[model samples]
Target: MTKTTTRPLAELQADFVRVGALLKQAREDVETLRRLSMAEAQAETLAAELEAIKRQMDRAFADEDKAKEDAFIAGIKDVRITEGDQRDNLIRRTFTVAVTRTGNDGLRDWETTAEKTGLTSLKPEEYAWLLRHPDRIPASILALADDPRTAFQTYFSSKKRGYFRGA
Candidate 1:
């Protein structure tokens, strides 16, 4: 291109004004992008915080429900001792099996006798095994039983007057 002569002062001023307007538009775009990015980051942070709060609320709800259930169970202690199914679901057969493996024939004998007698199992022999092998039972039952050491004793004590203890 041919070199032009120097522009008039007014033309130079107009060129500078156009350049300034372009620079200002570029700056406005950058500022808008920055604000959008920061807003996105803030929104992500808030979402994460809300998720944490939801988890906490779930845990608190579970704890509250458990406490209410415990209270409800604690209030119903009166047993009228009638002739019905005294099911013991808490006791597990693992205790009896462990006892059998340990060569404690007493528990095996008791299991055989229970089957031989007219005993239709409603909840398995877990409770009976726990009663016989109280020492070896799981720690989860520690608070549930009347006495971890003498749960079987208490059970046997509650047996019919004319009934003999296990074999």
Candidate 2:
């Protein structure tokens, strides 16, 4: 049971009403100002302010509409857009090795193996994906008396993500 700050439909309805009120007031002010003995420059300034206010009001309404549309779509199907690292800016490297059932004693050095198996600059998601992928080293590490979870930990290296805590 999570809490919601916005009351979905009602909040949106209220936002629409607020936008309408502000815009309607701006329009009325403009019409009344035009009939007064004001200089052209003065009138223009007032009109410009009204236009600016109207634009902000319109943005409010547009946001309300988009929220409603998103909610309606959410109710139909759980269509979610998930963002992942695609390694767009990464350089990928690959490797192959000969190994025994117990992972050959001289099979590979971590640095050498990484170079031989493959190394690449990777996006966050790609890093995570490779660690958990069946074709990756997760299964192979299990044979070397290495912790199986090491595969997961390796992908989380902060330098690769370009972020370091308390740096």
Candidate 3:
């Protein structure tokens, strides 16, 4: 046997109001979660777009630098201009691996000597490291650090902002 129960009209209405409030809160929570998910998706998309823009910027800068270097070299090689500065050109200091250009056996000799001396050949990272730790380096090896070579570095300048150049 089961007992039956009944509530007064006012009580039932109160119950309905409480249940309705709970339902409403649950609906709001779901909506909030959906919005958060959408925002995350948007953020991910934006990050990817930003990365793509960075890659494009890097490529554009590299292409421009190469073009500038090519033009500078060609001008010199073709004797169109001697070593001098032009309108966007400035004399820039640079370093190269201390190796001789003394004909066919020169490169081989350098490699052998470098290996025998336990000296890693000057690569980009090695060169940067050398520059960074100048204090730790000895004078003999340091003297091999060639005089700053002159390069026709290209650049632009404007009154509004200032100078701009590729690395």
Candidate 4:
């Protein structure tokens, strides 16, 4: 089994504060080095070092935000708003997923194949007629339309959205 240790919230906050100070000092150092008349090779080395530190700082901030989001998600479930002030800025945690088509079967020229398969043969008039007469629409299509999950899989994508706002 893997061993685990938990630190107090105070310690976590202290660690972040120390990291912030280190990032501030590293930035100052980079600015000071920029002011100096250094050789090209030396300047490149310093710039690379600064860039690495900046990446680390970015990761640190991202991790911190993730932790905050996790905590907020856990805490928000216990709270509710029956009635409250409208001016307060409500904060919330959100998650999203992205999907991209990965098949590489020369799909760029699929229109011709689709048309030949009668997939794209339906015209605006046919669609309007279908809408006017739902009974004519296929049972499968009607069933899928009634089911959000199936309809989402067939028509929508993997993109997700969420936001925090006043009620």
Candidate 5:
């Protein structure tokens, strides 16, 4: 024979309500966790996309800068002159002169007109000495300096504008 213990209906009903509330709270917590996980995933994806866009922008800026540099280099004329002494096989000299126009009055004035013949590398005293004794300079180099083409017919013919007006 078994003996059964029974509680009041009100008490049992209150216990059921409490269990139901706990179940609901557990479900809400699970839903919150799911939302948090989804948000973290979305943030990761957005961060990757932002990084990709930044890389593309960086590459674009680099390309633009390279193009500008190439254009500027193209504007300068590089003239190469080689001189060799027949008497001595080892005596050979090469000079590369970079010429460009100057002043705001078109290409009428040219900077480095005489100094562009590789003489700009000399010290002030050495240049003054050369000025006093021009015969020390090679005849071919002097002839090149005397050429009209070396004066006004080189590259960078346009006058500087905007930020480079005085510079």
Candidate 6:
């Protein structure tokens, strides 16, 4: 023999509602997890792409810098050759002048200094470049002058005592 049990209709209806609510919540949780996983994957892909772009940009910048440096070196070499030729061709002249300075004993002393002429004939740019790069000036040009700066200043004042032509 078998026995069958039945609950009240109102209680059975309440239990059905509770079970349906639990199933809906579980489905929503599963959908939320699926969306989260997809977002994480997309983020990883985007990050890899960003890293590749950064590397490419760095290489491009390095190439640009190398090109600029090469051009600058070539230009400087050309200028050096041209200026050296000009300096070599000049007709240099020399004269003597008295330079007075305070001695260690707090007394003024005078000394004869040999100065070069004809540097005033050089173009301004040529003179400026020679001034900036003293080593590039020919040894003959620097021989009598005190220094590159003083040698280049001859261009500004040719009337200075020892600088007169045929003097």
Best TM-score among the predictions, by candidate number: 5
Given candidate 5, what's the lDDT at residue 151?
21
Query: Which regions of candidate 6 are displaced past 4 Å?
Result: 1-4, 48-167
Clashes of 4: 0
Tens-place lDDT digits, model 1, residues 1-167 = 99989999999999999999999999999999999979988999999999999999999999997686554433222211112232533321122222121223555522222122111221233344443445554443344457754644433343424343441
On a 0 to 1 TM-score scale, where does candidate 4 land against the true structure? 0.25
lDDT per residue for candidate 4 within 36-76, as digits (tens), equals: 75668788998999999999999999999767655433312
Q: Which prediction has the highest lDDT against the true structure?
A: 6
Mark the regions of model 3 whose C-alpha exceeds 4 Å error after superposition. Answer: 1-34, 78-167
Cα deviation of 62, candidate 5, in Å: 0.9
Task: Give the range where candidate 2 is weakest over 10 consecutive residues by summed lDDT.
Answer: 75-84
Clashing pairs in 2: 94-117, 94-118, 95-116, 95-117, 95-118
In candidate 1, the residue pairs with backbone N, CA or C atoms under 3 Å apart (3 or more residues apart, or in different chains) clash, namely 91-126, 91-127, 92-126
| Model 5 per-residue lDDT tens digits across residues 43-161 | 99999999999999999999997676554444233233334543532112334333332343574744443234333354443433333344555454444345433422121121112
| lDDT by residue for model 2 (77-107), tens | 1111122243432122122322211132476
How displaced is residue 100 in candidate 6, in Å?
Answer: 47
Report the C-alpha displacement of residue 145, candidate 6, in angstroms. 28
lDDT of 3 at 146: 50
The local lDDT score (0 to 100) that residue 119 gets in candidate 1 is 16
3 against 6, candidate with superior lDDT:
6
Query: How far off is residue 42 in model 2, in Å?
Result: 1.9
Model 4 residue 5 distance off true place after TM-score fit, in angstroms: 89
- Name model 1 segments beyond 4 Å from true: 1-33, 76-167
Task: Give the higher-TM-score candidate: 1 or 4.
Answer: 1
For model 3, what is the error of residue 112's alpha carbon versus the real structure, in angstroms, after optimal superposition? 35
